[model samples]
Target: MQRRLADNITSDHLSCPICRDTLKDPKLLPCDHSICFECLTQLIESSRRFNKFSCPVDRREITASSYTLSAEQWASSFPTDELSLLLLQTISGDTKTETKLKDGILCSDHPQNGCDFFCFGCYKIICSECAVENHRDTECNCKNFKNCADLAREKLRDAYDEIENLIITGQDIVFKEIDKDQLLLQSRQQIRSTIKKLKTIVQDFEKMINRKCVDILSKVDSVTNVEELKKRTEGIVKDLKRVRDEVELSKSLTSTKDILTVLSKIPESLQKNTDLLYSLAVSDNPIELKLELNEKFLNLCETLIDQPIGTVHVVPADTIDFEDTEATVCSKRIKFSSDVLPLRALELDPFLAIQLDPSESENKITARFTGVIIHGHSIIAIDNANFKVQRFRDTIENQFIDEVLIQGIYDITNIHENDDVLVTSPGKQSRLIRLSTYNSLSIISEKVTENAYFSISQLPDCTFAVISHSSPTSSKKRVNFDWSRGVTSHIDIIDVDGNVLKHFSENFLCEPNEFGDPFIMPLKSICCLPNGNIVVSIETKTNSFISCFNQNARVKWTYDLNDTPEGVCFDDGKIYVFLRESKAVRVLSVDGDLKPVSTLRLPNYFGDGYSLFVGRNLLSVIDRTELIRLYKLQSC
Candidate 1:
């Protein structure tokens, strides 16, 4: 008995219905039917009389309006079925000779059965029968060849494109190097020419000095004395000219062989200094070539004139070192530094204090400050009651430089090496706001959303990650405040423009109210680590924990706070968790062990710690009332 066509050729499904052959650049129509570009073009031409073509499989009218003017253009107007093309490339043994060689390798033990699945564990291919019989264990998980082939083709294409880009990059680098070499040669020639001109100036100065000295000596009463002075001056001029010539020769000895040496010195010449070598290359500072008489000329003038002749004296130029100019501008004090001691060992004594009370001169501060962060030289504080953000100079607590009004300011965080702050607002329409660190009044970027955002953090790449819920802000109620507050069902990773790049949800992970099984602690504060992982402080009425999630929002590890964890922060690979009930800040390592490093007790004035910020080697926290305290971090 003969096998059916479908049984013999597994890729029959990938073939075009009209041509009954493997697809080539298959175009998909509105009816979900795909056909080869060539076949589509022929169908369109045949139906030109009616100005309409129909799908071969669906028999639906394919209007000319749906496609473009030309047949090639019309084919491109529709989406290409890349899956079918990849399938055809895999089974037809065409396009690539490597694919043909790969097809020849069948199942080793069961040669009759084609190897369809790739076992990742054994790093070998196996037939369905063999996979079921020999590799039944989960460790020997197998991937279908059809899917793996498509992935392999995509990876190879990416690698090939990368190599092509590298070739272009390499060519550009070679051309740039060649240009630099030419520039280096030009610099060498210019410097040599300059040295020659300087030598000529010195020779001319020597002749002038000799003539002046002879004229002065001629004033002597004795003719023998005048003659002796002339001989001495002529000898001095000749020696000076010879020295100039020797110096010029020394400069000219820098041949093409010393091109590397010249190139190496190019950076020094470009630096801020009017040295002879630098002046030759740079046009900003002009060189002054002048030769003046030594102290001996002044003595000769005084003696020859007899009546204490008024002599012109040349003063030496002061040497300036460019490196020391910065220090000269302003003297810097010695910076104080000490080893970071354990939180328990160091005292949380109030290093600095600021009153968060409303001021008549500036924008009124809210009774409570929701979020506080020390970004660079400014302390950013969020006023949830007034929907405002206040900026104060970190060094001087009294100076209030700026204030920004946001619609619903929930929390604020600083982006890595960026001057913008990421603020979260859970309002009628939840959104993420990027406010300027300098001028807190302006909004740099805002991403409005339908869901209420709890907290926002910036990844190392400057993209933002926000914890939000699926339900609208209006759905929240005070009666179910605990459940509603912990309603952070999903974490959305978005770009500057607010486009959600990636997101993961807790819905499938667990039901919002369900507990004890798949742990569900609604996310409160979020902080993205230097690594792409995120640390979120999650809490319930009774239970609290700090969970670290990978880029995909999958929980990598979780450390139980035991008490109600309020705010979360990450700095220098350490995770800081604020315990609202315990009235302390717990520092823990993010490693596998999740070891508790140290604990910091809240100060007397701090009623319930709401927010914590760790940056610029300083720690700032917002207290219950109108008080913001700062502490200098020390570790041993």
Candidate 2:
């Protein structure tokens, strides 16, 4: 009833390496071969033993970042025999209108497994024989591979569609956010412009008011003096009164005749003065006006800055402390109080968050450990993956620029403000390497009894206490089946130029070296109190412990933690220790007390718990894979 596809086929299938199981998320290596995720992890785990893990197909060296898969399709949705044959026929030749052939193809490589191997990209084939020759390797990531051409095209097409939609959404939101600010600014500008115009109008009114007054004053002054003005008014009034009295009496009287003559002259003079004043007043056209401004303008401006970004309210405080029962010391937990308030609300626009490789942000520093040296507009990471210093432009969009060309070192373990980088390259030769921004790589000239991994603590300028685990060149004391082990089994103190600052060798450490990833604890992992003492996490194979030593390297106290203390760091005024075997991270107080764990969520990190680092309020935990997990401290 069902027809098989790959049974009598040529090409179009691959095999699995680990369980010989159907390779679902097949990743091709640089060797033109493919392996499953499980097989890849096994290869990485076996690196220390082999030192070189290569693809079985072409024998090219495999690194962690180079695995590739055309599509993320799962193996569970495989096609059946008859359906797979029909699908294969349609994919190979032309469309098959047969309704019976729709179930899809059964993978010939693992025909019994019933998984299909027809890659949406390669169009070629891969049987279930993986860990042998799969194509998802890093080299196959680019376009134009015959086998994965179709898949790449389809995936790229879909990615573009999503990115386009995101960009459109983001642009729209950004436009609105910008408009919000612009609207406020524009309103303020308009009010100021209107006020300026009003001031001009008020000045005109003042000019008119003053000009009218000046005209009246000029007419008064024309009379020569205040006494003259009084005399004229009296003369006119007297003349009018004499005429009226003479008229009431006999008209033939001599006084009446004299009053008539004075009256005529009085009217003339009065008319002349009145006409002059009226004409001057007409020309001046004065109108008194009072300055007034809209009271609401100022109030509107005062509220713009503290306004909410979106639906969220942002009331800024210089510092915030948690109000939780389990709150750690000095921890200020910033919770997502509500989705309505966004810290970066303006970023809510449909921006295409094309998650590019974050490694693309920070270039690989060539030295062992590099410190952030903020110079100009660039933040230089000195210890690049190679022996070259990689520089990143200090901006939201970090861009890589020129690098310092060097050789023989890939990282700086610890960097200080003094531009000093501590490099660790203890393959066969053991040396304290120091690289400065100005000078090249230089090795410390101090000699110890045994050459092993060393970590140092700086006490003062050019003076430090070195912690080493080497036991007196002990050919006399033989290492049994169980002995102290760690990359930095020994510790020492050195200056910026790699000189032995001070030697603090103590016999206080856990024995039978079961500890791993020693250098994970930074220099801050150990410190001295005001009593002139020191506390440090000593690298021990069986039981890693934090040891306190006096100034003379005399072991004073040791806190035996019941976990494989692989990586440790200090934060929130306390020491946080990571246990590899138990998969639990503990926060220890400076006084050798463990606190409760509240916010570390790492699940897929299957490791010996060896890598950890603290940044701002979040802890970055790495399982030595391509993926990194960030555990944020919860706020009270």
Candidate 3:
């Protein structure tokens, strides 16, 4: 008897399907169907025709025509031509399905079995028993269900695409913002570099100027001392000569009466007269180490009388022992300083004149920016750069807390009373850099929005203004322009902490026509007066006049300097204004209603120049054809 595989048997010799195993000592039910005679009888009995399975394999329905086939009938019915190939194909498909089901790592919850269910919530895997056990519990600790987990996995592709697009777009925006910032920074750096060059030239030329002054003063002093001593000596010589001439005349008396009078003189009176004459005419009076003069010296004294001597104060600064390195001098009394052409945000459309048929505002006041100084807890100056200026009060402390190089940037334009620095580092690039004396430097603000040109100014009342202009005004007069106040310019007042307090056009300003309502501050130099009035130096916008307004923001006076005033300050009971074109410093009454009291003359031979007052005492004068003057005000 040969042994064979169970699957090799024909359908006529098929065994029980419930366990797909050979029948043991067979048990026959009353229906005469032989099945497993062990404890699996219940499983076998349920594998019936309507809704049953006699075994775990090949549980397809069994119709009357498919049941009880004879050996010859089964052989004819089964696929014979390609039976082996068809069966192998079926087995391969089943194997693939089983492999896919058990693809991932086995379930930790059911270590002995491969995972057949994917949990959606827990994002893990479990065998059938572990999954059912968790689900049957009221809590259902399973993290994920099979169906839901499939959905989450499908969403990943879409998410990846979205992230890619976002990254590309975000990078473009960041790059563009950085480009803009670098351009502005480069411009500022150029300005600083130009200033530095001029400063060196100014120093050299000023030295020559002071030396010339000292030489002239020296000549005047030399003449004065020599003349004073000679005059005193000459007076004594003249009196002595007069006395000798009188004695000679007396001896040459022509009348006999004078001779008889001389002979008749009493002996006692003669002795007294002789003694006095001797005293007056004595040349060898060793008792008179009193004075000695030769005839040649006397004659020289007479010649000296032709010219007199004078005194002078003009002297070379170099000749004086003046030592001050810190630029802390107040501009109040300084005539020449090192800081000159300090540039800040500005808005100008020289072509605007061509637009409104030359009807545009020729006045400029608000757009012009100046430096501010803040002094107190920490010293900082807000200048052209959009960062705070810092310094070390003590050298050792500075080494411990140096935040950045002052020369690293160019934005320090001004200072405040409290010294919290404000720099013009504008949007994205523009930052109010607060360099701590102890902490690392950081950018305080990030700008999501930007304006065209933001110029800044601060008043004494702790108020600051930002003047910004829109796109350039059209040069074409006939061009359609919505010049209504909003079209050209705007101003904003903000607190020290960057909160917007108010806008210049806050009052419902009526809309305008014709070259658009003159929407500009055009203010160049702003000097806050002790009386609360602001002396704002404005440029000619549309041929407008230079004007000064009261604290109520009222224009009290105006004077067309004709030349633009680049910087302005109050000093010595007067307003000192820097004239760029005129190359001069103009002094006016504090009210801005007077003529220049005095002008400090600069030698055009060297070069044209300008100056800005840094603090209460220091003046930074620059832009000279040859020299710059770092003038520190001296206490008179």
Highest-TM-score candidate: 1
In TM-score terms, candidate 1 sits at: 0.41
- Off by more than 4 A, model 3: 1-417, 427-455, 472-490, 505-523, 541-545, 550-552, 571-573, 591-595, 602-611, 621-629, 634-636
- Better candidate by lDDT, 1 or 2: 1
* Candidate 2 wrongly placed segments (more than 4 Å): 1-419, 427-433, 436-488, 510-535, 538-542, 591-599, 621-636
What is the lDDT of every predicted structure here? 0.64, 0.45, 0.43
Candidate 3 TM-score to native: 0.31
RMSD to truth, every model: 33.8, 29.6, 29.9
Model 1 lDDT-worst window of ten: 320-329
lDDT of 2: 0.45
Among all candidates shown, the one with the greatest lDDT: 1
What C-alpha lDDT does candidate 1 achieve relative to the native structure? Answer: 0.64
lDDT by residue (tens digit), candidate 2, 1-636 = 123443322233444555465453556555545566556656555542334466655667643322332122221122222322333443344443233225544445544332334444454444332212364454433222224457767888998999999999999999877866664565567568877887898689779868977977786566445476467666656766665565565446577666676556656666765665454433334344343545785576478557753352233321222222221122232222111111112111111111125344356322233223333444444342344445554443336566654443322344535555454332234445555544333343323223443334344344444443343344634232123342123345655545654455333332223543333222224433434455566443233666655666565555555545555555555555566555656554554433332323244446544445543555544442333344444431
lDDT string, candidate 1, 1-636, tens digits: 113432344344556788887677888787767788888888777765455777778688876664348776666688776444544444444555244346756678966455667776676777654665577575874556655777557757988999999999999999878755664565567567877897898689789988987876664433334466566656655655565565455567657655555556545543523243332333454444334657887896688678632343332212111111110001232222211222222246666667755766366754467788877777778767777787888888657878877776787777667687778888766787877766445787887765666667778887888777553255444223346454446788887666788877754332245555454666667788877987777654555666666786456665554567777778876777777765777776655544555666545644666667877667777754567788776551
Q: What's model 3's overall lDDT? A: 0.43
Model 2: ten consecutive residues of lowest lDDT: 346-355
